[model samples]
Target chain A: MISVLNAGNWAEQYSTIGERAFLSITMTVVGIVIVVFVLTLLTVVVSLMSRLINGKPGGKETTAPKRQPEAAAEKAAVEPAGSSAEPGASASERASETDGALIAVITAAVSLALSDSSQPSAGFKIRRIRRV
Target chain B: MNSIVDFFNAFSETINRLWQGSGFTNIQLSQIGMILIAFVLLYLAIVKKFEPLLLLPIAFGMILTNMPMAGIINMNFYDPDFITSLGYPENTIFAYREVLNEGGLLDYIYLGIKLGIYPPLIFLGIGALTDFGPLLANPRSLLLGAAAQIGIFVAFIGALLLGFTPWEAASIGIIGGADGPTAIFVTKTLAPHLLGAVAVAAYAYMALVPVIQPPIMRALTTKKERGVVMEQLRPVSSTEKIIFPIAVTILVALIIPDALTLVGMLMLGNLLRESKVCERLVKTAGNELLNIVTIFLGVSVGATATASSFLTSRTLLIIGLGVIAFGFGTAAGVLLGKLMYRLSGGKVNPLIGSAGVSAVPMAARVSQKVGSDENPSNFLLMHAMGPNVAGVIGSAVAAGILLALLR
Candidate 1:
């Protein structure tokens, strides 16, 4: 009979289909979120721990002008003693320069707390300081 | 001669029958009115550039449905005894006749809008385009995002008091989040009847964020507070950048189980983007896939706007309440921004907090503009993005809460 073929009469079957679709979508979404969250947490914890244990100190604030003293000190340490040492007032100047240098590095490290890391200019490289 | 005359008479009778069924009827005044209304919507979307890609198709669908005698979207195909039997049952003692189910173009659109499929896929595109660097640099911005979701709950309660059933109220409240996808998802599940009104309101307010947010922002903060310049952000490591979307997915899932699908799809897209491994998938999802879905979603949703069903007092109430919800949401974000501004000793720009409304780059851009107005050199785009992305997550979470509570 035509009545037997009427799909409208199969309300319960259609309802079950709709319900199953909803359940499938919901489960897939939840599963993905959980997986992504756990992995992200692991990465954050691991990176922070590794950085704390092995990362270098004072990674920022090494301006070109500020690094001159460190370079001069390294130059003095490497130079030969017989090479016309015009080391007169330069010795006191270098000593005072070392004191100033120590103060600058300390100040730079402390200021890191106030600076926003969103800006690339906020951080300084120690390698640049050593090169100068 | 008699036979020929009989054939001509029969032909005339057939013509009369067709004429009776083919043209406009007196009862089609409402359909005409709806078509005119749809024209106005189309004009607003096209000329004003107010979500044109979506509104245009929806308006066209509305027009199509309102056309008299057009069976473009007929719902009844299997009715027997077509001339006498009605498509649906009619409850009446005297007539005891079947009621014509009046299959209209709107029925097809109803299918897509009612299923709750389109908006979340849009979220997937949003996730792909979103970068979590700013949020990672300032993890605390997540709190601002969470705070912005106050609009959803508040509106939910308000809608309930307005006499909508729990499901209806929850669907109505999501409009405050100013997220079209979230609005669609919630409405499809809750009050499928109000889906069109809710969808329109959500997208309308999203496009109008710049106009709506400014007055509230100016009223809430002092000139000095607005002028405050936030410090530049630290460079977020690639590792931390990759970890952030994942962490958020976990934390959100653990807190609210229902929000997973919306949030999960969004974060999965984000993860694909951040991981640097699935560039092709990311690009396709963000652009091609998203665009195709938008077209389908828009046309289908528009089809739901049948003249009889959509032209009701309840639709007007949803539109009115939708504005209130968005205003409250914007205010909540600004207030939280102000709190953070105080806590961080004026180092934080409260302007960025307003980005927590889940309107994405628009809300975030508004924050940047407001900040620049205060101090021409103050750049808050990157900072605003943190809370802006957070707002997206927060709205999804709030939507989940509504689903659990209302459904």
Candidate 2:
């Protein structure tokens, strides 16, 4: 393990390092701080991206089909507790014509919403049909 | 009658000769002292449940190697012929390494500690289990993590004052990191002779964190301060989780390449965990594999703490400095937390800052527990976890820094 490089170079190496110690230490400290700062900045950006991709989607609803007026009247028919039962036939007959017209418009709007995305269109469809 | 008398005389003479020739005819006091120490460690592990996972095996190894005539870890390196003739009985031979690799029995045990392999692998297991969500939610906790590194440097200066070489001082200072793997890694690179002492000190303090940290926690903060409830952590998205380790790795590598092995492996483990695809590898790394390595690692480390090497004044100094380092580190973290609390308008609980000691989840859980005692609804676990995990990274980086500087 003989060294061909002379004693002069060894002294030179020592002298060069002595002059550069301050610079080297300062650079190291500054470099570490910058690196830490950058890493953290990157972490924040990535965190935001992941949250956006994985967050719950909002402001959407589903719509169900509307019932016909006669069907609606029939559907709400309350049976008496007694052994005998009635369909409330007189009431159904009274409202059938007007109710059927309203029901037809509601059905069109409800089906239109349902045909679109099943999410959150019901509220809009209901409002439109009620105005009609 | 004359023949019987002569035979009895001859038997007595033979017994006297045998007694004179044997080496251990009288027990030495130093051997007695070592046995007592071994018994104490054993009792502590078994009865008191003090780091029983490591202490028990270590205690057992100490007892075995300490026995006077056992040659359990003893070696005769002076004689080449004796080394050459070593092998198992001809009837049975295991697939062990060649004599050079195998060395002597004690030499083999010493390898586990010397190579610095086992502890970092343990860290990999720890990294796999650690969740960095809290860190992602509140990135400011990184400051507390950085603050805790003050203890390491403080101890380093103290070691230098005590006439230790720069490398030895660096190894001693890493005990303040309160990270066993970091301590082991640094010492392995910097001061191999002091490995046993430094490792023992780090683990001992870690086990004592419950006892050691509370007084410091209470001393540093007011009751009102401890009681403060932190704001809820915003949800950390999966994309952020994936990028966190990658970003840390690149930034850390560019700044201090020496840290890459520890930091790289650690973040890689975390990446595997958060990526959510490598469930099988994660399971193995975290549980079965970790346990197996820990046992071997603990025993091998204990075996290295032989009486001849360990019973020195330097060991005492190392232990003392280790305690000081851990205490100072806890203080720095807590003080930083207090500063953050004031800066955040009391939104942050200062107690969570103590988690920056790099004891991982235990220190974090303690912060949460202590906080909840003051305010039942207060939740600091999530907040504490950020610094806790960050401290692990910071300490590893610090260890790497010391390694590079001292080397």
Residues A35-132 of candidate 2: C-alpha lDDT, one tens digit per residue? 35544554455445445665532111111222344554555555433323234445555465567678778878677767787575554433322334
> lDDT tens digits, residues A1-132, model 1?
213212244234324544434432343244334323433343354345335543622111123444666776676677754343445336766765786787688667756754756555544444323324
lDDT of 2 by residue, B1-407 (tens): 99999999999899887776543664356666666777887888889887788777777766666666555554333122443466544422221344245455655655555556776788778878888888777777777777777778778767766756556877898998888878888886777667667877887888888888888988999998999976666666677788778878887788778888788888888898999999998998899878887777776666656676577899999999998888888998899899988988887789988898888777898898888888898878888998898889888888777665555
State what share of the real interface contacts each candidate retains. 0.00, 0.06
Mark the regions of model 1 whose C-alpha exceeds 4 Å error after superposition: A1-132, B1-18, B74-113
The best candidate by lDDT is 2
Point out where model 2 deviates above 4 Å. A1-132, B1-28, B74-102
Question: Model 2 compared with the native: what TM-score?
Answer: 0.70
Q: State residue B107's C-alpha deviation in candidate 2, in Å.
A: 2.8
